[model samples]
Every structure is written in C-alpha cells, then in structure tokens.
Target chain A: MSSRDAILARIRAAVADAPEPPPVTRDYRTAHVDDDHAAVVDLLAENLADYRARVHRCTEAELPALLARLLTDHGSRSVAVPPGLPTAWLAAAEGAEQHLDDPEQPLTARQLDAIDSVVTGCRIAIAETGTLVLDAGPGQGRRALTLVPDHHVCVVGSADQVVASLPQAVPLLDATRPLTWISGPSATSDIELDRVEGVHGPRTLEVVLVG
Target chain B: MSGTYLGMPAFPQAAKAATRDTRLRANLRHATHTIRDKRARAVGELDDWAVLREAGKRIKDRTLRHLDTYLLQLEEHVTAAGGTVHWAADAAEANRIVADLVQATGETEVVKVKSMATQEIGLNEALAAEGITAYETDLAELIVQLGDDLPSHILVPAIHRNRGEIRDIFAEKMARWGRPAPEGLTDRPADLAEAARLHLREKFLRAKVGVSGANFMIAETGTLVVVESEGNGRMCLTLPETLISVVGIEKVLPTWQDLEVFLQLLPRSSTAERMNPYTTMWTGTSEGDGPRDFHLVLLDNGRTDTLADEVGRQVLRCIRCSACLNVCPVYERAGGHAYGSPYPGPIGAVLTPQLRGTTSAVDASLPFASSLCGACYEVCPVAIDIPEVLVHLREQVAGQPGHRAERAAMQAATWLFEHPAALAAAERAASATRALHPRRLPLGPAKAWTETRDLPQLPAESFRSWWQHHHTEPPTPPEPTS
Candidate 1:
C-alpha cells in the first residue's frame, strides 16, 4: 500500500468499533445567507472591527490610491510587497520604494531590518471569529513578507472567498499546505497580568477589507 | 520521582492508585467543579457562542487539510514581513534548531514565556545540554523549573503542588536555580508570587535571547500571536535582543479575521475572562522596538502523523484553551502528573497517545483511563468529542494482533449467542452452578475488573423458560375487530 493508503488503513483499524465520522460535505445552505458574497465580506469586516482589528474598505478601482494613502498615513518610506500582490495596488504609490524582494535572496540581516510594513492578500476571512487567514499563495507571497515588516496591510476579497461557519470551512483545507491564522496583532501578558503588545509578529495589524 | 509522574507506572496502574486516593479525589473534585462551573458561565455570556465554536472548529479543519499550502504561505509571509522561518520535523530537530538559534545569538542564557511546544520538545533540557541556561519567567513554570519537575497541566503546570509544596520548592530549590526565596518565605500566594518575580526579574533583564510559542500564526501577514494572563511573555518577547518562537504547525490559522474567533474563544475558555490581560503580536523585526532579530521555528513533532488519521485529526482543532481539563472527572482525581506528558486531562488522553503513537504500554493504556462519560464533550469549547476518540483509540488497541486471546474470547461469546439452544443450556447450567463459581478471577487481566465489582447473581429460572411459562393468554382478536 502507498503511504496514504497505509495511513487510511490504520485509521480504519483504529476506528473499527467506532461510529464512523460524518462524511465531508459542503451542501448546507446558510439559514440567513448573505444576499451575495459581498454581504458576507461586509459582515466579516464589521465583526473584525468589533474584535478591535483596524478595518479599511476600498474598491478595486480606488485600490492604488487607498494603498498609497494608508502607507503615507503610517509614515512609511519603504513597503514590503508580496510577490503576488496586484500591480495596480503599487502603481498609485509614487513616493514609497516598493520592496517585492525576498529577504533570503539579496537582502542580508541588516538590509531587511531597514524595511517597514508588508501588504498582501488573505486566503479566507472567517466572519464568526473575526479572523483573517492567509495561505501564502502567489499574490500572497512568502511568510516573511508578512513577518519582517512591522505594519501588515492585508487585502480581503468580498466574493466567493468567505465562509459563514467552520463546518463549512473544513473540507476546503489540504494538510500539506502552510496555513497561518491571525486573530489580532501578536500579544502577551506578564506575571502581574499586565498587557503588552507587539512581541514578535506585528505591533500594528491593519486590514483592508476590499472587494 | 525525577519529575511529575516520572516514576508512575503505566496508565492503568496509576489510575488504579489515583482512584483510591481520597484526599486527591477531594482536591480534584473541588478544583475541577469550580473551574468547570466558571467556564460554563463565561461561555454562556456570548450570544453567538455556538456559531463561534463552529467557526473555530471549521477554520482549523480547513487549515489542517491544506496545511502544507498554509504553512508555506505562512513562511512566505513571515519572510516577506522580514522574519526568518525554520522548519523542524520533530522534537530533536526542533531542539537543534532552537539551540542553534540561541547559540547564533552568542547568548549563554535565554528567557522563556510559557510554551507547550517548547516543553514537548524538552527545549530547556536540550538548551542546558548545549550549556545554554533557559530561565522560565511564568510563575508556575518557574516553580516547575526550580524543582526540576515536569509540567502536568497546560495552563497551571504546578497544579499538583499545593501552596505549602510550592513554598518548600522555592525555599529549598530557588537559590540553586537563581535568586533565593526571601529570608522567610511563607505559603501565602502573594509571597510566593513576589519571590518568583524577584528571581525571574534579574534573568529577564540580563538575558540577550528569549524563547516562546505562539497561540496562532497568521499566514497572510506572517504575524505570530501569543496570548497569556501574565505579562512576562511580553517582556520575553520584547526585552531580549533575539527572540525565537517554537510553534506547532497546527497552530497556524489563515488570516487575522480567523484569529478574532480564537481571541474570543480562548480568553473565556481558559481563564474565564471577557478578555485576556495581555496579548503580544510581532512580525519579523523592528529596528527600534522589541527584538531586532526574529526567528519562527515551525515544529511538527507528531502533528502531521496526527493529521493523517481522519478520526484523530480532530485533536488538532484544540486551541489549547484546556477547557476539557477543568471538567474531566478522571483528570481532576488523577492529577496531571499521572498522565505523564505536558498536556494532561481529556485533551492529553487523546493527544498524547496519538502524538507518541499507541505503541508503548503507557500510550496504549491512556485511552482506557477515561470513564466514557461525555462531560469532556460538553465542556470542550472547540467540540473535540473526546469520548468518541477514546472509544476509537480503544478499538485501535484491541485490534492489535497481540490481542488474539481477547479476540478468541469474544469469538467464543459470539458463537454461543448465535446458537441460542447452546446459550440457554449454558445459562441454565451456570445458574445451577452459581455457588461453585469463583468470587473473583485469579491474578491476571480480569483481576482489576473483579476487585470492586460483584459477579451478577444467577436467576432461579432461565429467561427462556420463564417467558415460555408466563405467556399463556392468547390475543383478543374480537376486541380488535370492534
């Protein structure tokens, strides 16, 4: 048997006496389905904001201008762009130096230390949890794009990408893939229970809830 | 014992001993009941709790399915965000990677936030082997470290030790580890905490390297998230010049939006709070703030193996909130040490066996430790259905070829049932021979089962004959027609 087949056989043997697990399916319809995918995205954005994540909404037509404005607002001179980020998003930003370079390729440790902020697209946005998931696809680029930069500006699409519940989300995953789930910016507390922010990931997490 | 449950016998033996400890039973009963009650009230406050729970479970399932893609994406995002990503296949690989990271920093000592991933890898021991000292900053972790004990509970590692035991551990061992407990340390909670703070404070400030584990890692932004009640994690995350995090691959979620679900689920499920006191987030490196160098070690010890099993994969859905531990009757009485791993309680029962592979005597015995009561299912915020997994693991154990004797026993019973005439004859003979039957089986597999439970009293008449004699009246067909 192939490794996968062997694994499956072992699972069968393990659960031989167990009632079988429910079969995977994506057939359940939402009781109150969003009018369209955009409504789902909107709900996701609203819930994200409710969880204290800073949310920004922009149209594809106005994307570049909004991207520039958000960067300028953060007072950033250099921005790390994921390899797969839309070209138009960077087109409007005139003054800032665009960095699509992988830190591993040309940049040394010191060189990467100079860059500020990273912007990319997410794989899925869970509305129920106010979470943004990135599968690091082409437009999403490498994991470093999200980590090395202090400010993370991620784009979320409004249609065909959102799932109402987690049961609706499971069958969509593939185990071998690299998955990252972020609820909010990285944080930790002390012995006295004092709150502190920005330890390792990003101090400020800015989400652009765009269609 | 070298550590918590270090010398304890395999699961069945330890559980048997724990079942008889009246004082231990009282403590576990009181503690678990209180925490479980508080957790329920905390969970009930949320209007969309069921929806949130479903969402959390779904997001985890989806991510695990496409884990390779998400993990690659996470690495890409972290690199893009200006962070270095290292992949470690197992505990040895993870320890080597972390030790190398610390050695690269040229730091002899490292401060740590409470991280189970690190513990699972035995990172501290590994670091010490490299002659690099690791200071545990979390209060409970400090106690465990000073005493050279293994952690039993995920949230409270020292749950097995009462206040008096803590005071003794501190007064006796703290000085050897670092600073001594104040001249006269008392069993008072405040005094113990104060002593720990003084001891850890020096290490936190002097250390050039820090180590941690993230509750969740965002793939989109390459952001690693750590949530804790204590602020020590923040100091370790920031104060050190080099920060290294050893994170399980399963902790990865796809986006920040997905992260929000757990931020809500974790706080209430863990400490029964509307919000955790501290939440630390960082991406890559910041020149002027926190660690200028950041490295994320993605540790995949037994997670991939765990993920491969369809029934067992659900264990990955755990967010490490440890709500199941608070409600488990077995966990409360047996204590975390008896389970013999970092993760104890209901989660430990299913998780440890799968991670370690149910090949060892201890691993094989873990699944049977539970009562098969569904309390864990009801209390689990992520809805892991632990009882179902326990039964599943049990089947796995029983299916092994070594259980041929058991198989033969079952087969004999099956054959007797199939032949009712034989079964009835046997039953009648057994009923007549009841006085001759042994009260308990001789020393062997059935000895434990028969110790407390009594053999059923045989009936004077077999059911077949009793039913045959009692059913003399015929059906009233005329009444039915009317």
Candidate 2:
C-alpha cells in the first residue's frame, strides 16, 4: 500500500476500540456582549487601541476632511487606494498624489512598497477581538494592498459592518475570498519578550470608525 | 526527530547541566513569568472560559475520533479548490517531497513561517543538503537562524536570547546573510525589530517559493489559517508565487464553524493577546491574490501511531499555544533545550516520547521529567491532562528492560508483605541494627533520590509490638450520629 493507504489504515485501527465520540457541544456564548451596535463599536475601538492601533472617529460627511488631516499630519506624499473605493473620501487631500489601483493593471508589490500609506474599507469589524476583516471586496483591493505599505487607514463604514465576536463574523465570511484579519499594526514580542509595535506590515494602523 | 536533538543524553543528565547554568534559568524564569501573568489576565476577561476550553477539547476529540474520514474530506476539498495535496508517512518523506517541489520551481531559496511540523522534519537542514537555503522570516526564528541555534520555545523560539545578544548577532552576522545591520544597532527591542525588518524585507520581496505550516485546516472549506504576531507570516503567505504548507494530519477541523472556539482560545492562550497582529486565511489559490500555486502536504510523522494508544492520544489536541510551557515549573527551570526536541516543556515531555518512541535513553527519560504538577493541564485550553499522560508513559517506560533492579526490589517487598513471619523478622532485624543505618544511602539505584533528604530513624520496636504492649484491640468505633 502507498503511504496514504497505510496511514489511513493506521488511523482506523487506532480508534477502532474507542466508541464514536458524541456530537460537539457549543454551549459557549455567541457574543460576549449584548447586540448593541454602538457598544460593540466602542469595544472595537477600545480593543484596537489596546493593541496600539490609532483610533479615529468621524461622521460620513466629515470623512474627507478627516482623511486629509490624517494623511497630511503623517506627512504622506502618496497614498494607495484600493479599486472601487469612494473617490470622495480622498477629495480633500489634493496635495498628496493618489495611486488608484486598477484591478486590470494592478500595482506590483514593489510599487506598493514605495507608497506612503493605504486606505480601504473593511468587510467586517470584530468587536470582541478588535479585528478588521478584509476580503478583497470593492473597497478592499487585494491582500497586498494593506500589507506592503507602511501605514493603513481602514474605514469601518457603519454599524452594519460591525459584529460582536468571531462566531458572529465567521458565518458571514466567504471562505473562497482571500481574507486578511488585521488586529493592529505589525508588532513583535520576540526581543526579550517585550512587545514593540511596527515590524513588516503597516507600522501605523489608523481605523476610522464612521457612523 | 531532527538532527538537532540527535544522540542527546537522557533527561536527568541534560537537565543536570541545564539547571546549573544560572543565566539560562534566569532567562527562562523571566520570559515564562511575564507570559504567565499576561495569559491569566487575558483569559480572566472571558466569563465563559471553562465552557470555551471544554468546547475546544470536544471539537478536537470529535475530529480525532473520525480522523480518517475528515482527512479524506480535507484532501478532496483542497484539490477541488485548485490546490494539490500530498501525503507523507514520515519526516524524511515529507522533506523529500518539499525539496523536490522547491527544485521543480527552479528556485534556490524559499522563505518560511515558523512551524513545529517543519522543525520536527528538519526541513532547512534537509533542503541545505539538497543545495537550497531556506530563510526563516519570523523575528524569533530569524534570531535563531542567525545565531546558528535551535528553537528553545515554541512561540518565542529564541526566548533564551536577550536583546544584547541579539544586537551582537545582527551586528556580526547580518552582513553575511544579506543586508548588514545599521551602524550602532542598540539593544532596544524596537531597534532590534526594525533591524530585522530591514534585513528580511529583501528576501520576502524576491522569494518565489514559500513554505509554511497552518495552525488550523478547515476540512469542509479547505481554508488554512496562519496565526502570528509579526507580518513575516503575511509576507511569506502572500508574496511567493508557489506556496507549500506541510501540516500534521491531526490539525484538521470538521467544519468552518469549529474555528470560533479555537480562534477565541488560541490568541489569549499563546501570546496573551486578544488577537495577534495578523491572521491570514486562504482557501487554495486565489485568481489574483496571494500565491497562484498552492500545495498542501498532509504529514503523518508518528501521529498515526500516537493515536493508537488510548491514554497517549490526547496530545494530538494540542494547538501549539505554548501556554503549558509558560506554566510548567520544570520547563521554567530546565529550559527548552533540555527537552531535546523542537517541542519543549510539558507538551514536549508527553509528545516527544510518543512521536519519537521511548526506546532511546533520552526519549525514555522524558516521561519522568515532570514533577507531576498539574499546572499544564490547568492552563491548557483544550484541557489535556498532561500529568496523567506523564504518569502513563512512566508506567510504560518502567515496564521495559534496564529497570530490573527496581522490579526486583518491588518483588522482594511484595513477597515480604505477604508473609507475616518474614515481615516481623525483617522489622526486628531493622530495629536491632538502627544505630548502623546511614543518614543517606552511599550508593544505589536510589542514591540520587535519597541524597536530597534524610531517611527516617528506625524505631526500637515495631508498631505491632507497641500495639501488643498497650493491649490495643482495634480502637472502639465512634458512635454514629442519630
């Protein structure tokens, strides 16, 4: 027999004496907190901040100005925006050049690395773990969009995009889509067990929660 | 399982020297205490911790009970999702498969994410033998690679290293690898991380083949998840053209939804964080994102044999969180190197002997390395009874040869206890020679054990004699409550 067959035979023999295991029990809570969007978003903000992601709040109408101020303050000369992002979001930031990614002719990793920052919207925001999920949706371009750049400004558009926990988020996510779960800027605790933020991924993570 | 731990001495001898190295003990103590306190706080935040831990244990148990079925399902799903699947019965086969894959791509180098499965198989050394150099991308892994060292801890592979030592490694060796460290790299963690970023970026951007191991593989969807703190995992998972993941077959989960329990348990248990900085999930190859060519190597290096033993199979439930290591007193003092395997601490003690078999002297000694303290089980998210497994493996080891002296001693005692006359005579002879008894045994199988404490003083008379003199029938039974 091939190694595959031999191994399967071994596994079968291993558990032959044992009875069938019972169906798994999932008595754990689906959501640690009540289903209040505002409260969940608050928790997300706290958690993102806890991991050293700079948290910013802005209204939908004021998003353009806020984006401009953030980019200008960081002294960013160029920003990479994913394909299909709202053009109006970067309307106020005319001083900085925009490298709009065309899905047909996508920017290379080398080019993405040269850009100063990236701005995109997320598929879901997990409140419990303070995670932002990107699925290469219309606003989120691809895996490389948020990864190569030094900074990321993720916009959690509304409460509909917020979930209380991973259990609530997992069902809605499509497994076929490439998923990137960002909790904070890149960080490492490898050096003597002391956590220092900003390694290879975006050093500065600015999550703009727009209500 | 790797050349790194080849021909290692048994646990007693290895730990004997390790305990004397005060610097190693101090490093292990500091790193373990920091993570232990943080893990407690992180776990304390969840009100349903016990239920969550139980759910994790049950899911793993259910998956293991039907492992053959789940593994077949996983292969079918992966193949359907534009991914190729391969099977290896052992480490040497797995390495040959990977080396052939890398050579097929016509690449001389491959970047890697930190993985225990790969370490167990000794992938880098195998690849080097094939004229391929694999670069380790994680910060701790990079430190280990640069220092020409073996991984000491699971999550923090270079926990034995301090910043000063790392600074020196980078300063001395960075140029030899690729980019030299910047002038005057200090001992600050931020600076060290920055130096590593600069050094590894060139390799990550240019690599054509990437190797990894997944924390969880969802059988239903064929999606594999890599949980990590640094973005090295992201770069390796995304940047390369061809991605090969060598995962142990036991890593499979029955469904996509099963991830909820582990996703909640793993982060807090491993790094004591609510969530690690990056978690990348992909189902096979994507049309325009990540790697275009993906291969999944399902490795069964001793996992099948481990599952055969009823008492020893709970070890497959481990998620490689390293929480058991942080809480183990033996691990904290003796350090990870003494375990003589990629896996260290409580998990290693139970796991190495099963995976490698206890025929070797070092492997046989692993079952006795523990003090039977149950801290590892208490902090274990999946609720594996590590101490119970240790004792069970100890029984198996004692039953083997080379323990004839201990077996003979036990047999003599059993015979003496069965014969009342012989026992009485023995006790009287012991009382008669009380003055000649040494405080500590000079030499014997128990010399090591007896050297730590004094033997009890033999009484002039036996307990039976005292009872006879005091006219003690059995003591009167206490009155029962009405």
- Scanning candidate 1 chain B in windows of ten residues, the lowest lDDT window is B1-10
Question: Which parts of model 1 have CA positions greater than 4 angstroms off?
Answer: A1-211, B4-8, B404-442, B449-482
Cα lDDT tens digits, model 2, B68-166, are 999999999899999999999999999999999999999999999999999999999999999999999999999889888889899999998888889
Candidate 1 lDDT over B5-118, as tens digits, reads 434566756666766777656656665666666778778767677877777777877777667667778888888766888877678988998888888877788999999988
State fnat for each of the candidate structures: 0.01, 0.81
In the order shown, the candidates' DockQ scores are 0.04, 0.82
Candidate 2, residue B186: the lDDT equals 95
What TM-score does candidate 1 get on C-alpha atoms? 0.67
The clash number for model 1 is 91
Q: Please give the distance, in angstroms, between residue B377's alpha carbon in candidate 1 and its true position after superposition.
A: 1.6
**What shift in Å separates residue B230 of candidate 1 from its native position after superposition?**
1.7
What lDDT is obtained when candidate 1 is compared to the true structure? 0.72
